[model samples]
Target: MIAWRAGAAYPPAGPFVPVAGGRLATLQAGPERNARGTVVLIHGASANAADPMEGVGRLLAARGFRVIAFDRPGHGWSDRLGAATPAAQADRIAEALGSLDPGPVIVLGHSWGGAAALALALDHPERVSGLVLVAPVALPFPQRVALPWYWRLAAQPPVAWLLSRTLGPPLALYYLRGASAQAFRPQPPSEGYLERARVPLAVRPGALLSNVEDLIGLPAALERQSPRYGSLSVPVLIVSGDADPLVRIEAQAEPLAKRIPGARLLRLPGLGHMVPWVAGDRLAEAVADFLPEAASTR
Candidate 1:
């Protein structure tokens, strides 16, 4: 296998936190004591922590809040701990947070990262003071969406191993622009986001396999976990674009806002899945509403 270093593209914006799986890579900003609560950012499939949250992280940092972003297991500079379920990843992150000692935090999760953030709150409510979910897939759809035929093929060990080593990187590279455009329909991404975010890191042999397994396992995991959302004690803010081409607003954000007793939902008009890039500081401004001190200032 090829060894992938962290700083080549994305840069090491924070220290690596040692964990059971591997040294978890993180990007952090702000030590502004006058700021609001600490913020933890978790990114989704095919992305490292800095991918979706970079702009927002900077904005929050400028506002004086400590912002921390982690490259989840098996992606970016982080090593593959195992094939982890959301809850399992949550446990590992909890330990990582213990090492940081940032105190109770505001957690922001995008897409698949949203599930793990929810799991963190479910398993350890005292650790999360508030939550922000952007274009999340937090609820179990009444019916399972169909997976591609290739997903079935990859489910098998022999086929998966062959594909990961042979065709994965090429395929991911070939489809990069098209997929990003589709996901961001109605709004374009910032120029060169793919290169800036180091999209190639995700398509590396082992990362590809882990992402596939995570996608395949999501339905079952949400089936087991969706019921626990209402039991979470933290205040929540769920944001989605009405035009998001990836996760359905009705299927995820709307229903989740209703399900979680007091969770606030914001449906952005004419926006798409890449809201962090497309909307930028506006999203950060809305996120500030979740923190008590930030909200008071707002």
Candidate 2:
């Protein structure tokens, strides 16, 4: 894997923990002195845990809850484990949380990370207090991603090593800018978002492969998970942008809200996929309202 300089540019928000045969990077905050509950932030694909959740984590931390953000496997400083399976990724996170012992947690997952959040909630409902899935890719739509020829070859382990050695770096570098633009669509990134988020690192060979697997393998994962959504009894807040190009709200979010009984839906009129950057404060407020009252001493 061609590790990006940004991996060394700055460390993940917190230390790394050994879990699931790899190091999982975690960023944590909140005053444990009188914490109500834990809020676990799971970031989307191509972006690490820190960049996307930075603003919102501070907001939630100030609300008297412990906030923990994780670099999803193979993204940021976290070692690449079996990230292709959202279930495995969820298990890795659960193992990490077990080490922390924060008690039941409110999970906030964005985009691809939403799938992980859902899997965690599904498999371990006792551990998850509530869910705030933003622009989540939880439902399998009819049309799935059209994997690039390079991605097809990259997903294969035999040629993947060779492909990563030769073409992965350059391709990731080239596509990242356009990818960011698409993610923030109908509006550009907020000031310093590109650099602050370490956008270049998505080009790193490992991260790119993981990203491709996430895109290519998502439909089946969603298909497998969607049927069980009704069984999840946790309070859920489904937030999405009406103008989001990446995960269509009409196709994914609306139906998802219906699947989870009494799941609350919040729609931003024209925001794009990057809700934290586009409307962090508003989203935070909405989340605070949706969450079950956080006890003063959890």
Candidate 3:
């Protein structure tokens, strides 16, 4: 695992705690003495909490929020504890929340992280004050579509090894650009935009492999978890980009909005899956607006 930069501005805010036979790396920002509420952010597949949530953390902290982000097991600075199941990840999150000072907490997750967040709310509802899902990949089983053939071919063992060593980096870059182009509306994405967008793909080691596993496993996980959606009574916000290719807005977000009673859905007409980074400020504002009520004590 890559060692965290020593004396880095964003230092580890707490001790690494053992969870599910692995250690989770955690960081916190905002008031150290007294906090109003806490927001726990979980990043998408192949990316650690820091890479995806750093901008959001800064924005939330500026708005007087205690923001906590963690590298889930097997990613970034956290211990590799094999493939982490979504249920186990939620349990670890619950444990992390317990260790924090008492306060309301809003759990926010992106993509694969959203699946874990939903699982957490279902398994430990009392720990969460509300929920926010961004470009969430959670959907019912037997995915509406099949994996692209290239993705399937890449999953093969020997071929995967070769691709990882020889063409992975460039291919990863190409895919990022291509995906961003398709997702963005009106204007074409620039090199600078692609650079920031690709950061999540670049930072994680063995990202491709992990992403493949996530795509394969998530459908079943969502199928199992979908039935319990009605049981979630917490205020929920689901954000999705109408143009998002990675997750179909109509197929996933539309049904989810209708299913979760009183769930608020924000559909950005031309936005893409990279909305968190591409429009971080707007996303932050949405969260800020939604949080005030959820933050208030019931």
List the RMSD of every prediction in angstroms.
2.8, 2.4, 4.2
Question: Order of candidates by TM-score, top first?
Answer: 1, 2, 3
Candidate 2 lDDT tens digits, 1-298 = 3464656765565878888688898877888767766789999878887765575887778887778898888887788787677787898999898888878888999988899999999997767888899999898765325455656666787677666657878776767677778878988967777787766667777777677777777777878888999988778888999999878899889999999987889999998899988888898787777665423212
- Candidate 3 wrong stretches, greater than 4 Å: 1-15, 101-103, 141-146, 149-205, 296-298
lDDT against the true structure, per candidate, is: 0.80, 0.80, 0.70
Candidate 1 local lDDT, residue 81:
84
| True lDDT of residue 161, candidate 2 | 67
Error of 2 at 247 (Å): 0.7
Q: Estimate the overall C-alpha local distance difference test score of candidate 3.
A: 0.70
TM-score of each: 0.92, 0.92, 0.80
Candidates by lDDT, descending order: 2, 1, 3
Candidate 3 TM-score to native = 0.80
Q: How far does residue 174 in candidate 2 sit from its true spot (Å)?
A: 3.0
TM-score, candidate number 2: 0.92
RMSD of 3: 4.2
Model 1 Cα lDDT, one tens digit per residue, 19-118: 8857788888887466677889988988887786564788888887888898888777777788467887887788899998887888888889999999
Clashing pairs in 1: none
